[model samples]
Target: MENFNTDLDIAIIGGGAAGFFAAINIAEQNPNLTIAILERGKTGLQKVKISGGGRCNVTHAEFIPSELVTNYPRGEKELLGPFHTFMTGDTIAWFEERGIELKIEEDGRMFPVSNSSQTIIDCFINEAKKHHVKVLYNHSVKSISTEAYGFTLKTNQEDIFCKKLIIATGSNPKIWNLLSDLGHTIVAPVPSLFTFDIKDERIKDIPGVVAKDVEVKVLETDLESEGPLLVTHVGMSAPAILKLSAFGAVELARLDYNFKIAINFICHDGEQCMDALKTIKQDFAKKTVSNSTQFNLPKRLWKKLVIASNINETERWADLNKNQLEALVDQLTNAVFKVTGKSTFKEEFVTAGGIDLKEINFKTFESKRIPNLYFAGEVINVDAVTGGFNFQNAWTSAYIVSQSINS
Candidate 1:
């Protein structure tokens, strides 16, 4: 490892999204001040490179700060103040100013027009280089200490001192420990943005089937989401399930990672499902019950629905009794799956807990107790549902901290 003793105006621990962004922003704003990003891994921006299955879901296109912030299960309340300063619009503008244009999908996920995460990685790398930000890979910070003048960081490579320190190490426990040891309170980290593994025959064969708008509810909790739902080989995924996983992350972890999830395959407001079922019975009276679904559910899913509803697949829709029709409506509208366990959503996973939000000043993302000590990104107790909300959190927090550091 290379060793250096040069003093820096700011030393950012972790070269992830928030760290690099903060470094670039600070260096660009204050060119005379030296900034360094110390990363533990062999390569910086590992998460950014792998996010969105390599395309990098940069940020959601939601312009309304209040609406966009609701996606965050952990940091929604604390992020309100920060989003007012730098929201999704600011994130897009920041990237656009660097020559990277972002495109918004129908689902509101924003990705680079290049359709490559490398576009984002290259942008950050080039910006950091342009600003002369020192990026030290494989230099893991072991601890940090505060002094009257500034802060001191002990890393595997060498010891360094800086006037300001930003903790952007993300959701790693080791990083959390270093901060906690530095007198920062850390909320225990728990897995977020995962999928529920349900071993039910209804969805067993149709692994890749997706529902555009489905609702998922945790059996005994108020956690719920309405969005796209994907049926995976192991279980269920997609935006809705992923969002549900985030909201129930801490509670699910406490339950030893085992819980039951109820899924309403179709989201009907009130008695619409019953009315639809009656219409289906009347319109498709000659068709087989299994062949007469009201909506565009997959064929295999229709079969499963018939089986789960105890209606014979070959039975004509006209032969369906009142009880059978009600059961079918219930199956379509309030399908409940038994979620036995959980698995990580590799594309966009985050931790639910981190530095307690109460301890940090949301307006600046600065530690209320520790002067000049700031926290951003996943390092703090803030995580959002997939679709660029997580990246937005990183951006908003980093932007706020940058302003605070300059102020």
Candidate 2:
């Protein structure tokens, strides 16, 4: 392959999910356009290789644009119209047209039937090659400067010029600094989609116990979520906690990772739990309180809660006095724990801040402040909860950018 006839028609920064997708789609549609992807790493699509535990969750099973947009805590309102354009259905069709099939899990996350991220990466690489998209590796952009006709990107290797530019670098501080210098507002980035780190007597020594359909609330804040909760060696995780983390990313960051959360293990009302405990005391009079699990809770978790309520392991249900019964109810319905810190959810490190959303036009994913410049993925202050929502945003925004750039 030649170096190029002249300057590139399009230059995409970052070789990750959004950059690769936008480059491939744009070049596929405009085969005559000269485009190149500047990747800092030796290879591109590193995030795609590790996303969704290496299976690469492509998109969610959600069909409705409005319903799907709700998964994005930051871009919920902005992504509604874009999802209508190239959403989950369009993503599936695009992959299927390329001879790749995706399967939906019970949790609604869609992954390749092969259950490997390599499939998606291979497709992107092949598609880019077919469209003559040059993938330049080890070309980290040192800075970005605008030209009268286009933009100049100063990289470690050399200076590359392009008439149109797209910044797809996700959660990059240097890139953000460049954008900030170019008169764009960058909201300070904070960690998102992380698991809480906790140490408590109730959850000690029980790592894999799961309580389905539990309610979790960040104490003293409006943050609340409910779903299946998993007791990890550190603290609690799963959907219930993940949802809270995504939605409260900014607020939790303000708290300096030190906050208290009240969890309802049973997802039952206080009065209702009390009534049921009394009924259980009468029905299972001879059964040991810690031995009999109720409300579909895991036995180990039930025993922990029972012990935390000041009930002995051998204490029978009939022996729970009124105060003890109340304590048990409180333990089940309003158990509070201290979250000391947070751990990145798997290898997925998502940030809740980026270029201010108002700077970009959602219609074309092009920068309103800088004409012919665009942004996609986590670079645009848009992020979603786990379960394939983040990838969906990538597809939607990159597709829109592709379409717009082609025109």
Candidate 3:
């Protein structure tokens, strides 16, 4: 085993988004302090390279601290002050100052004007080099131990000592186990931000059909969300299901990923939907019930629902009986589907658990139990729904840690 005799002033474990952000800011704040980033991967920023399908959703366009913090399910309360200090606006200015201009999409997801994740990777790499931050790739951390003067970090290649340590490892169970040994409570990790899997005649073979602005509620639970709903080959995706997946991550996990969900394709109440259906029946009495798509839903989905309600393709609206009308109304208003499993959403494999938020001080993102030890990003029990909010958390927490270190 080899040991590095020279000790660094700051050592950051994990070279992902939070790790690099912290290293760059800390080095920029204290140029005289020697800092090093130990990353296990042969190349760092892999997630950044693939984020947002290579465009790298940098952050959200949300500027207000209170409104912005609501996107985070776990750290909403603790992050209020930290977000007020450094948030989406600060993140934009930080990148803009570095020659990267971010553009906000219609959905509020901010990405570089170049529309390439490589741009973000390049900026981080260049900033680290310009700030004189040492990025040690392929140096996997073996263990972390507190010493008299500072902390000792044992890696596969060498043993490094630092006066301060930062753990930016995102959702890595091994790192959480190490922190558990260091007297920090580790929340049991569970998969979040997943698409529900369903096998129903309604959504089957309609992978690209999307119903905009629908409401979905998990049956027997209080979990519900509203937004776009997309039909995928396996089941369902899009904002509505994704939001429910995130908010009910723990509960759904407790149910073993098998549950039922009711979807309001029209986003209307039962009576209102029935009234609307009756009006449609009168307006299109001569037209075939299956042929006339109402509620602005996709024709294919409407046909499926019509058929499910016992109305045939040749059944005209005028021939539809009261029973059929009620069935159609029920199917439209409270359609239930069984979710047998879940699938990851693109490259954003987010988890709901991490280092318990109560153990860390949001002011500096420093450990309350262990002084000089800090955390940022998913290593702590903080995660947000889809959009660039997760990256925003990384930037805000990392920037604050840098500021606190300088103070």
Off by over 4 Å in 1: 1-5, 269-271
User: Per-residue lDDT tens digits of candidate 1, residues 1-407?
Assistant: 55555588888988999999888888888898888999998998989999888999999989987897788888777777788899888889999998999998998899999999999999999999999998999887777888898898888878889998898988879878877887778888889878888898888888888877777777787777788888899998888888777888888888876777666777784388778777877888899978766577777787898888889878998898878877877787778778788888564567888898889988888888888888889888888888888888888888888888877
Q: Please provide, for model 3 over 203-253, each residue's C-alpha lDDT reduced to its tens digit, 9 standing for 90 to 100.
A: 887799999989999989999999999999899999899889888889999
How much is 136 displaced in model 2, in angstroms? 0.2
Where does candidate 3 stray beyond 4 Å?
1-5
Q: What TM-score would each prediction reach against the true structure?
A: 0.95, 0.98, 0.98
**Model 1 alpha-carbon miss at residue 300, Å:** 1.8
Q: RMSD in angstroms, all models? A: 1.7, 1.2, 1.5
Q: Indicate the TM-score of model 2.
A: 0.98
Worst-scoring 10-residue span by lDDT in model 1 = 261-270
The best-first sequence of candidates by lDDT reads 2, 3, 1
Q: Which residue pairs collide in model 2, if any?
A: none
Q: Residue 94 in candidate 1 has what lDDT?
A: 92
lDDT of 1 at 347: 48
